[model samples]
Target chain A: MQPLEKTGNILPLLHEIRHALEDLLATGQTMVIDLQAMPFAPSELVELKEILGVGEVSAELHALGKSTIQETAFSGAWWIVHFNIDEKMISQTIEICHIPAILMAQHADIQMGLQQLSSTLGGVSL
Target chain B: MNQLSLEERLRLHGVSRRGFLKFCAATASLMALSPAMIPRIAAALENAKRPSVIWLSFQECTGCTESITRSHSPSLESLIFDAISLDYHHTLQVASGDAAEHAREQAMKDNWGKYILVVDGSIPLGNKGFSTIAGISNVDMLIETAKGAAAIVAVGSCAAFGGLPKANPNPTGAVSIDMIIKDKPIINVPGCPPIPVVMTGVLAHFLTFGTLPELDHLKRPKAFYGQNIHDRCYRRPFYERGQFAETFDDEGAKKGWCLFKLGCKGPTTYNACATTKWNGGVSFPIESGHGCLGCSEPNFWDAGSFYAPLSTPIGHVAQNAGYALAAGALAGAAIGFANKQKSSQAIEKHEEITVNDLIKGETK
Candidate 1:
């Protein structure tokens, strides 16, 4: 069945992302939009992805689950989809930022790594 | 047993910051909060300690438990269920007989006045022998257990509102939790069997924020119950365009036109069915080519015919709409215009749906 256009949430979300991109440029702000918050008309999500297209940067993180981080065609817009160990998609989001926060190493993990390195080399820990 | 915060537990489980962020993002969405609040949810979750939950089941068919059990592992709902201390549950617990009672008593003693009490099924007040566990009446057990609870979560329509057992000719004199316990803060998760995500969402909110989420007049979480199904329905366009399916096997039905004429109660019923869906994102009743049974609302079984469309008079435009609105709302439904209307207001809002409307096949 075709969407009647009167009850469409996809276009409004695209507009919201555009506004978020502008906000990012003006104030150095970042934004995350939860794609699963609202129900989508069938195939609307696929249509959205097609519209955004794909960008060069795409990476996968293996933590408790497999998380795919890909930049959309729009430079600052990133699409991140996470799957549980069982391969179930837990969450999907669109983030507008310079670099998505999850891609960076956490400070606590870095500190622990540094301490382990110092102990391994018999050197003073910073 | 691990006296650690939720973050600490996830870290020990080898979950990284990224995984935790994914969890938070999913959780925020499930709780109907914006994605911007993920950081706050994460921060709050760092210090959030797991509270003990005591699940009490009575006068139930175990559909609520079945709904929760159907939830897959590692989903936020199942994850939170694992995170919390589910001290006593009759269906899942290993202990039985006196041993089971002992486990319940021990959990209550350990976390007295701080533990969460989750009760499913209605309480039969007429006959003490109507429903009992280990020679103890359901009402007695509920009253006794409620005394020390931090908050009470009435799960499913049976416990939240009087469900099937409390339908016409209700022999057991079954009444809801709110009717019995007025002292404690009760959060009603009403559905024939509530969506498992919503049940866990309430628990997640309590775990993260140390308080219950905002509730509507029916004591349901506004996040899930705030919008009626019609508003969120994909068939809404067909409904607004006045293109309705006249019969179950008609041309309009094949083309996926609105099912209002087929007695779909989507317009009157309020729940997260359209958005949350059921059986893990599979289609809901309306999507499956069936009218909503209005199961979540009170006295749904007695609210005229499920096959009868919500009647309206074509003669009076304003009068017919108000009458239709009040007819649904009178049963304590969250119909769009009059969810807050009093009984007197509902009576005043009522207008007649004459036989001529039916004769013309023009019921609204």
Candidate 2:
């Protein structure tokens, strides 16, 4: 199949996403762009990223294996990549929001950290 | 009576202010309100007095109540519903017999011209014996209850468009709420059982703005029913490219092509099922492999068979074809003769080229 036709024409989908992203930005709402729903070759994925460009903010999440998050040039848009235990690609998506939810520490995890810190401080001098 | 404010009730439910704000933001987005309106929505819902709601059930299957109550346990939608002063709901309230009738009367009297009147099912005007609440006929009860309403909400297809109870016969003479209540502002949220969030969303809008949200010609909220199902369908690309599934188990069906040829009524039907989805945004009928029944529209029962393709003429297939056939024959013969003469001339003028002529190109 031609490289253009291999992806089953995601340009229309991209147009829709762009419009939705604009609406999300305007409304302060978060939206998830599910890449799994579309058939995009590696080259097409790279092309999509290039078209969207990249911003300055990026983060690495180390909880359940390693996941990388990158922000696009668009004000509130982001790209997140998750990997399996074997470092194989698990899932990828373009998330539009003021900040992606993956980087935030859960309340339970924060409580655990607080408990550990207070117990250690109680034993130590300072 | 539940006297606590919405914010106080939410706090009692263990929902934080931030969580409540998030719910407000989500509600605003769903209603297509601006982000600037988020804070306003939060403020309104927070301190808003719980409006009394009198739910009247007539000729319904209890599906609308079921749909609105299908939210998760301790869900924001459920909490919002809990925040409302639902004074009388025959299906959910514990009162029975004369007590239920008294409760409805007391609610309407207490909150005269202030409470929201929610009606489900169609009103039968054929005979007073057709349907009744206590001893009052459905039509009489509706007319009496709707008199002092701030606004009437017609939930489900029955209340909005005289559904199955009013199908094709003249027996019951069932009619919608809008057909009877001409003085009051009626907001129709028509669906087989409307999306739960939509019901709550409309309530939120009214609570926030103190007025009904924008509605379409059918009195359905345009925010939820603005776009046609086909336009928002996931398999729309297949329709645009002329790919369709002829049968249930065909290759096109297996490949998840469009269901238009399989009697999908998505093109004309307008609803939010395709976008908002059903059962907690899981999947709608088309996604689960079935044609739309056009349940939200008026007189959908008489629309046609659910399995007949939209291209197929509904009532007079053979008669319409017979009429078209005679006209087509005359036009076909003339076109066929003209085509024969044109093709013969083209063939006579045709020239053959050798392999060397391919190198010579078109100029030669």
Candidate 3:
């Protein structure tokens, strides 16, 4: 595919990300840009990722298929890509935050863990 | 699977909360919902009861069934089916003849007033003999089944809008489900065969909320059909710049220019084909360099030529579209063909060779 960069939409997106990163630093506000919602060419997506580059932290959650969460070269800006069981890209997002929400443990799961840990203890004190 | 709760089914599938959360996030994006709703969606689906679905096929090609069932493995539709009880589907159900008819009756008797009624294909009204299931007429069967249904889901253009059967010469006097079933809330999921994910999305919404999703004037889910294909089209830039592909394999075509002149119906048509896409996100029709057939809309088969510009509606497809335009209205902006003179002028400005050669190498 061609760059499809003729529209110059990439420049505005970069500016948006920069502004979002700034907002994160100043006010601790988190922003998520849903990549699928926008009309992005495949080549344009590649261009955006290359310009963002890779950062220090990267984690892959092997849950429903495989999803990767990686911080870009710019701190507080992370890229998260989700795939289905067949390993097709389903959702991709650029989140401006210290940590994306999917990484956090869910409350219900925590409660279930607590129950399991209690049963595992079985009269033994921690 | 039918007896198990969605929570139990997920437990059996070895899906964790994080995994389920990932699914919900993807679904939220698919439904055009914000990230904030992901948690709620997860909670609702995790504990959802298995709603029995009774599918009735009338005047259809069974393409809708094929589209939904033959979906890629571990898809949302597959998961939804695992969670719900598909009590009857004439095409998919193993039982046939009297056994199949009995199953439908038994399911209706069991879940009456609560089960979902999914109707595919148009309903013939010309004569009772035109279409029948076990000697029962289409209208009679629809009216009988709809009476007990909590809600009716009109799947495919046939069931939703009388499809091809009700075209210019509508032989069987075919009519859509909504035209007959008035007492029930009908959700129309239209397409020659709607994108599989969309049909599942509507089902998921109903399962999660215990109610139908917000619908458009056409009764299609607003989230999926709200945006115009042209607005979200990748070649929209070409249209804005007044560059167009006058022919299929011309210089402009190779350059990925706008297809408006080649008769794209993106401007007026509404559907999720552009964003949600089809065939597991491979590509949509426009991306493959064909005009939108507007198959999801009422009387789409009768719409102007798939090759004629949307503005000029005098071709084979246009005659059908003209009537709908009078009643349905809006043929979009009257783009002047005067821009044909500018095509050659823009060619001189292009200098870069595309990466098609590399793609050709990869194919080899």
Candidate 4:
């Protein structure tokens, strides 16, 4: 809760992530940067996000968990942070890709939703 | 001859104003300039004339040219290079023989004291026949070509530092361009074929500002060579934590540990490979899991085994310092006598010797 205290240097990590984004931009492949392993305070996370800066676009997902995904100023880069039911910080990662995979609706969920919509329409006789 | 400015060329090539501004921003960051300089860079580049560049290659493998020209696809970097009036380049020039020589002579004459002279490879001074362009010896050709140039860009380790050709013993008596041309303001871009973008970046800086960029002690553009690879390396965190890959196939290596123990010369070497990367910023040598060979440093070939640690002494030494001291003391009188005899022999061998004779040790 106190801005996650940073025990390790973050500049080198950011440098690596920048290069990973470069690869993603060129290859159209996605790169995931796992920040869960590092000891990062919530404060430090906030500071890092500020340093990364935000893009115009952002999205939120509420399926398996409450996830906030946002793009950075650098093209093809995204930061995703997950929160548990208690709203405590659980995991954080930076993804470099055209579009974040977490935002994609699962095929099974889409099919199930379609079937439910059809059943509702049938009952309503519309 | 009049040519379209860089901005005009970009417009002709369908690069939008927004795209040009983006490039300016990227270049500004690349040169370590603040974002505020973006507008200034854009303005400079917009009206910048494509200067005449004369490229000269001596005793090199053509890797430098290949790195700058062929590394990336036909991108903005290549487009800028193409936009320049490259008057002379043996490998790339279509003219051959007398026609090539005539073209070089004409370019020098036309852009007298105005053209940029970019040189790759070391100059061999062992003999006139060691290396030559057309009928002129390497040193002769270099001196002649350099006379009328405004500024010289020594582009690659060979031209900047003598490189492999100037290694210990130096069979061809190889020397860098600086050794020959002292009058010209020389900017060295030292790397065994420097990063493609670094080479282009230096050119862009020159085109933007009609003077050379700020230089380091080694005369390399400070923007690119200012930081050591070790300082910017991603594995530096591992190194700080006292983690290192002891061997190529070790667990640490597999886990992407620091390559310091595996003879990464990144600590001593200065270049932008770690940050800018290679092959479209995809991955540099360190990212590919190999230690830096420190190709950007001078005399890297004679620096010692690439596999050896930085802490290891480069030269062989006596097993015991005490024994070496004792041996030196024991042989002192004999060495003095031998020196006297050698001096007498030198006097007897040459009737009248000049400075050149002393330099070449040509008494006999």
Candidate 5:
């Protein structure tokens, strides 16, 4: 396995990962992404699992140099990804793999419309 | 001689013809008897023979006396003095000092073991010095007078359960008449100031039957205190619909919703106030928008704050709480299943049991 350098531009990486998973789903292959090495929120993990139709993702904390990749089959194809990074590298990786800007921009527009409707109708503002 | 009609008997007894008729009308109304019972009441009253009486005033405020005096129909003058030979009443008798005490002794001597004793207060036992009427301790006076009486009528909350005087500290050590006079039959007509008609009604019942009316465990006449006020309350429909007045002058209050939430004690109080009412059947406290203070119940003053709600639980675990919801759910399910089963059975039994046959079977 080759080590992928963790980068500060995390959103681009996350968008690419989501697109890759969506393509893999269209090809009728199930995918499971192990987030054991990543410092991420459980709620975001749950949302990611729901979006990808993955079976399960296990999380654990351990010392450096002991990290390993466990391969599993999905619709007759085997795939795995593993990495070991310092705290700074982890933060840079998160920044690079955060949610996409286009989806955020769309969400902002929807929220703005909701706020206007609430103000006009005297209901809860978004 | 059986020679006098009711009108003639009244005349012979010094009750004028008009007074006798008026008494009959008042008796009929008080007893909730039909107007037609006037003649029967008249006959009963005419033959009553002025049952011997011994009136005792113990540790009381004399409010019961004040209340009976305000009766407009027959009036106190006619009811006490003429209707029955009031042998001894400290307030009403003209005699005073030793003369009054001698009269009481003479009346007891004349009608030994044959007079009705009317007690209007509690007995104080904290010390002999707590209460004394005419230089005699009330405890001694009550016990001495009660021994020779035929029956006893405790005529207010004071005499029934020591009333307000017995609340909390109860420094006087006040106790009801029932606590002292344990031998003879006792009837309690309890209220802050008992309704006048109820007092007279019990007297009339005793006169007519020659025995006490039916009584509850509290020794109150069951005819009057038999049912809880809630059972007969006019605002019960609003309670059934879950409507309640949250405050005294809210829209719900004006609309006459149940006063349960506003500290109404009617639900737990047993009395005839809701039905018999007060002030000549004009209106009771609840009718006037004030919650029931439950003045008739024993230890009413100490039964917690008068304006506090019943403190009953109001959810599924409450005695009858969630009953409507449970019943409706079960009934709806049962009806739907029964209908489905009936339709399926109808198809199977179509030829044998026609609709006419089913109707005939139902009738049979």
Candidate 6:
């Protein structure tokens, strides 16, 4: 049997993830996301967090209580986002469900805005 | 018209000629002075009158006194109490009650502006009632004693930087002698318990010169506190090569690599521990495979976690990564282009020369 191709376009999923990340960054709040049981590698999780403008990413080895994401996946695939201000973890399930194209565009715009802000404040590019 | 010889002078002070000369030699070596200075030291000491000194114990553990008392060679007790006229030390004085107070009072009255004052602890000022000795608050006692002192030597971290008790929250509001007595020239011999040799060296310098030695901004003698422990560290080569011990007994640690990753504070600590070492220059903490805790620097306790590595990005990774990649790519393209040019040139040269002409050239 032919391997089943991923049914939905990944661009829309990425856009949704990007919007959630932007909101989290702006508000400095923790967010829970569902990945819809899609399996992904560690590198994909790292790339997803980077693309979503998460600064420093660390992974936990255990599930946070009562979350919808599997304990193993949460421990293995969840990414902790770091900034000078704070650190927060993002669930792997949420990442897989929302890899949308508009999210990539928003990520670029946010990165550019961050660069401008850093340059203005520090008098040097970050 | 009779002046005693150097031997006679030393004998009058109860030091044998051999003992006096040996002490001169030791002093010369300790001060990093030329051997020729030994005779001068002997001569100076022979003619020199014993300087009056007043020992004050404030809010402290008496560890400084204990450390000094234990000096193995030419013990500090003999040097300060018997060798020089230590007029008053609350712990050492034979006088008691009113008599002890009278001795201090009389010493100050007679030697006003000439006696050396040695303080051994921080003065707690949070409340005037925090610490008292002999019915006098330490702050008030310190201020009163420091008034007529020719010079002040704060003998430990307690009297130098308020020490462990002043670490954080600082509820007692302890302060060093410099904070209270700004008018007098103060020399700080600071350590958990300062090196015995350092304590003697400062006193020797004063005894020989009748003044304080050159001091740093922190009022420390430059001779001992000038260089950072890392500058003279044996593991410095390992640090330079990026070899570090991840944990206490790990493989890297077994090989004696840098302890920086193990939370060594050598980088920021300035002290003579590495060079001078402890226990008569025998060994330092780093030599025994422990990272320096930077106990000598001010506010070291509050700096941060002691075991955390002073994290800095490794290599030129952040600065030259792009340049290196670009250079590699350019080098690859240049080599490809050169190979293409060489092959094309060979083809053109082969096409231009007939086989017969090539054979003719070889034959010729």
Task: In model 1, state the lDDT of residue B145.
Answer: 92
Once superposed on the true structure, which residue ranges of model 4 sit more than 4 Å away at CA? A1-126, B318-364
For model 1, how does the per-residue alpha-carbon lDDT over A1-126 read when each residue is reduced to its tens digit?
544334488789899999999999999899988776677765678889998989989989887678899999999999998776777776788999999888989876677678788788886544
How much does each candidate deviate from the true structure in C-alpha RMSD?
Answer: 14.0, 14.5, 18.3, 17.6, 37.9, 32.8
* Candidate 3 vs candidate 4, DockQ winner: 3
- lDDT, candidate 6, equals 0.66
Report i-RMS for every model.
2.7, 10.2, 2.5, 16.8, 45.4, 34.2
lDDT of 2 by residue, B228-320 (tens): 887777777778889888999987887777889888999988888875677655578887878888888888888788888777777987988
lDDT digits (tens) for residues B99-173 of candidate 5: 988888888998898788999988888897788988899999988988888899999999999987788889899
Higher-DockQ candidate among 1 and 2? 1
Q: Give Cα distance to truth, residue B105, candidate 6, Å.
A: 1.5
Which residue segments of model 2 deviate by more than 4 Å? A1-126, B1-4, B32-36, B319-364
Clashes (N, CA, C under 3 Å) per candidate: 0, 0, 4, 6, 5, 15
True contacts kept of 5: 0.00
lDDT for residue A77 in candidate 6, whole number 0-100: 28
Candidate 4, Cα interface RMSD: 16.8
User: A-chain TM-score in candidate 6?
Assistant: 0.32
Instruction: Report how far off residue B167 is in candidate 6 (Å).
Output: 1.5
**Candidate 6 per-residue lDDT over residues B1-364, each given as its tens digit:** 0244444444555543444554564464455454456668877766665677899998789888887776433342244334456889998779898899889999999889999999998999999888987899999999999999999999988899888778788889998889999999999988878866677778877777687888898999887787777776767767888988899999888777889999898988767676556665446788788998787777766666778765644345656989988998999999999999999988888756566675644763
A1-126: candidate 4 lDDT, tens digit per residue: 112123345687789888887777678666666553343322455678888899977998653235688999876788876543334333456778888755666454467568889999889964
How well does candidate 1 score on lDDT at residue B334?
A: 54
CAPRI category for model 1? acceptable
Tens digit per residue, CA lDDT, model 1, B1-364: 4478888898788776766777787788778788888899999998888899999999999999999888776766778987799999999999999999999999999999999999999999889899999899999999999999999999999999988889878899999999999999999999989988889989999999989999999999999899898889888988888999899998788777889998888888989998888876667888787888787887776777787786733245688789987886776555533545666687888888676655665656
Best candidate according to TM-score: 1
DockQ of each: 0.41, 0.04, 0.33, 0.03, 0.00, 0.00
CA lDDT scores, all candidates in order: 0.86, 0.78, 0.86, 0.79, 0.66, 0.66
